[model samples]
Target: MNSIDKLRIVFMGTPEFAVASLDALVGAGYHVVGVVTAPDKPAGRGMKLQQSAVKKYALEKELHILQPERLKNPQFLEELQALKADLQVVVAFRMLPEVVWNMPPLGTINVHGSLLPQYRGAAPINWAVINGEKETGVTTFKLKHEIDTGNILLQERIPIGENETAGEVHDKMKDVGANLLVKTVNALANRTIEEIPQSAASIEEVTFIKHAPKIFTETCRIDWNKKVSEVHNLIRGLSPYPSAFTTLDGKTMKIFSSEKEIAVPTSEPGAYETDRKTYLKFACPDGYIYVKELQLEGKKRMGVDDFLRGYKFN
Candidate 1:
C-alpha cells in the first residue's frame, strides 16, 4: 500500500453531489480506474437521453465508465472484476449488491450525507432540515449488506442554521464530504484508520435515530394542521427541489421560503390571509406562515412582493 503503488479505485455515484467526491479523489491523485453510474434515461420535454452527472464527469477525466442497467448482469460484473480495483467509493448512489461492494480488496467506502446511524437512508440532507435538526454532518463508512448500516470510518460535523434551507445545507455538505473523503482515503492508504460498528454502544450516548426516507409528492404537500414552525421547517426542508406545495385558487403553488408568525391567527388552520398588496400568509395549527418565495402552477418562481403585485389570493 505504498503511496506510489497506485491504489486502483472505483467510484459509484450518479448526481451532482457525488461529482464533488469524484473530483476530489482525482485531484488527490487517486487512481480512479472506473466509474459505475446509472444508465442514461429519457428526460425533459423532448424525452432525450441524458447521461448521469457522474458519467459526464468521468468522460471528461478520461476514466473508464460503467453504466449497468442491472447490477447482477454477468457481463457488467465481469467488466467490474477486470478493473481489479483495490477500493470503491460510493456517494449519493443507489444501493449496491454484495458482489459489487465486496469485489475490491479494501472493500467499498461510502460517503453518506449525514452522521452515521442517524438519517441513514436515501435523502439525509432533506430529512435533517425537515426534522429541524440543529447540527448535521457527513460520514464515511465501510459498505455492508444493509443500506447505510456500515461501520464508521470518519465523520465531520457542521451546524445547520435556523433559517437555512435544505438546498443551502446540501451545498455545504458537498464540500465537507469531499474533504472528508480525501482524509479517509489517505488514512486507508496508510492503514492507520479503524472502523467502528454502528451499534448503539458505538455512539457516544445518543439514543434517538432520525430516518431519511425518499421524498414524495404526498410528503411535500403542506400540512397546515401542524404548528407554524413545523410547517415552516417542512417548507425549508424541501426547498429548491421537491418543494413543499399547497393549493391556491384551486391551483398548486410550490413554496420555497417562508417565515413563521407566532401570533395566534383568527382564521382556521389551512386558511390563508393576504394583504393583497405585498404579503401572503397561511394559517397553521398554532399561528401563520408568511410566504416569502413561491411559484404558482404554470408560473415562474417569484418573491412574495412580486407574487402579490399580479395575483390576489381571493
Candidate 2:
C-alpha cells in the first residue's frame, strides 16, 4: 500500500466551509479515520435542533463522528486517542487544546482563510474585503502552540473583484481551499513538501501586520463621512450578514449592494437623495453611495426600487 493509504487521518470541522475540505480528502481516497464536529444546537424560529454541515456529510459517509461539548473533557480526549489517528486535519473547527492537537503522531494541520502572518484570526475573509485588498487567499499550515502562527505548508492566492462581497469571496475560497488541502496532504505523504515559518513569508521587517478580529455591532454601522471607496468596501465586506447599516427616517436600513459615485455631495453626509421611483442614494462627505439592494427594519430585503415603491419618508 502507498504511504498515504497507510496513515489514519482525523478530520475536524464544523461549518459548510470545512465540509468542502473534508469532501476533497475523501474524494482523493484518504483514509480518514473519524470526524469531529460541533454538537447540534437548536436554531431557527422553531428552535429545533440543527446538525452542523460537517456532521451531515459525515453521516452520509457513515464515518465515526465525535461531538464533544468541550475539547479538554476526559472522555472526548480518550475517544479521540482511541481513533489512532496519525494526523489531524482541521478546517473551520474551534480552537484545539494541546492535549488534543498534540496527540496525533503526525501533528494537526489547519486550513486558514487568509495567507498566514496576515489575516490570522477569526474573521480573515471579512477583514480582507473590508480593507479593500486586491488579493487574498488560503493557507494550510501545521498547528502549533499559538493560533495561526504555525509553519505554512501550502498557499494559493486569488484575486478579489473590485466590488465583491465577503459572501462571494467565501464561496470561491471554500473550493480553492478544498483543492489545496488535498495537494498539501499528498505532498506531505510523499515527503516532498518543505514547510516554511510564517515570518519568512514576508521579506521586509515591517512595523505593522494586518490582523483579523471578530466583527462587532459597532463595526457594522455605516459612517457616511468616510471616503467613497472606504465606505463602499465596508458595505461589501459585511454584506449578506451583519450588513452595513445607516439610519434612514429614524429606521435602520441595512445595505446589501451599492455603487459609489465620486461626486461632491450637495446634501449633508447620511442624507438621502431619491426620485421616489428609481434610485436611493445616500450622501457621503466626498461622494454618494447609491443603494441597489437593502433591508429596512421591520421590512423584507428588496431592490431599492421595490422598497421605494411602497415606502414613504418620515
Candidate 3:
C-alpha cells in the first residue's frame, strides 16, 4: 500500500461499463470518499424511475452518493467541495465543467475507450469495429479543456477479432479497462508515472486519423452499395444496440450477425435471395452478406433460419 491508500478519492461514472472500474477501485481498497452519477430517470414500457448502474452499486456499497441535475449547481458544488477529494476518477460519464473537474488537488482522470489521439468521440468502441480495425485499446489520461484531448497517463492495447461484434469487444475491453484504470491510479499515487502529450510526434505521424462520432439512425442503415467487407463490419459493429437495419417487405429489419461471401454478385446491391428456408442473403458490390441473426420490427430476435421460416415475403 502506497500513499494512494490514504488519498481521498471520488469516483464518478454511469452505465455498466463504468461499474467495473469503480468496482476495481473499491476492491483494491482505494479510499473512495464519494460517488457521483446521473439522476434516476423513467425507462422501459412503464416509464418507471430507473436507477443508473453506478447509483445502484453505490447504494449497495453504502457510499456517499450524489446525483446532481447539474454539476454547476451551487449546492452540488458545495457538497462536492466538502468531500475534499485528493483525486477524482471519471469513466463513461458526461463531460464535466472545469470547476467540477478542477476541484480535486491531483485533478481529474478519465478512462477513455480509445487509445487517444484517435477515435476521440462519444462512440469509440463502436466506430473502431465499424471501421474494421484489427486493434483497439483503452486509454487513461488526465482531463483537460478539450474532450479526450487530455495528456496520456497510461494505455493497454488489445486486439479486436476480425469477426467479433462491438458488444463482444465492449465486454472484453471493460474488464481490461478496469484493470488498466487501477494500474493508472496506483502509478499516479506512487508518483511513478509521467504525462505524455497526445500531440507528441509519435501520435502526429498518423496522417489518416479517424473520428468516432455518435452513431445515429442514418448511420445504422445498411449501405448495400459498399463492399461486402464494409457491410459486414458495419453489421457487427452495431450489433446488440442501435443495430444495423435494412428494409424488408417495406418493413425495417435489424441485422445482429452476418456472414460474408466474396463471390461475384449476380444481383444488384440491396437485392436478396432466399430459398425461404435456410438463408437470407443480400448482395453488395463484391459479394453477399448472409444474415445469421436478426429481428424484424415489432418482433423478437431470432436466427436467420427461424426468421426465414416465419417471414413470408409478399
TM-score to true structure, per model? 0.96, 0.97, 0.98
> What tens digits encode model 2's per-residue C-alpha lDDT throughout 174-214?
99999999999998888899999887754563235789998
Mark the regions of model 1 whose C-alpha exceeds 4 Å error after superposition.
2-5, 200-207
CA error at residue 179 for candidate 3, angstroms: 0.4
- Clash counts for the predictions, in order: 0, 0, 0
Clashes of 3: 0
lDDT-based ranking, best first?
3, 2, 1
lDDT for each residue of candidate 1 in 156-247, tens digit (9 for 90 to 100): 99999998999999999999999999999999998989999888444553467778988888999998999988999999999999999999
lDDT of each: 0.92, 0.93, 0.93
TM-score (C-alpha) between model 1 and the true structure? 0.96
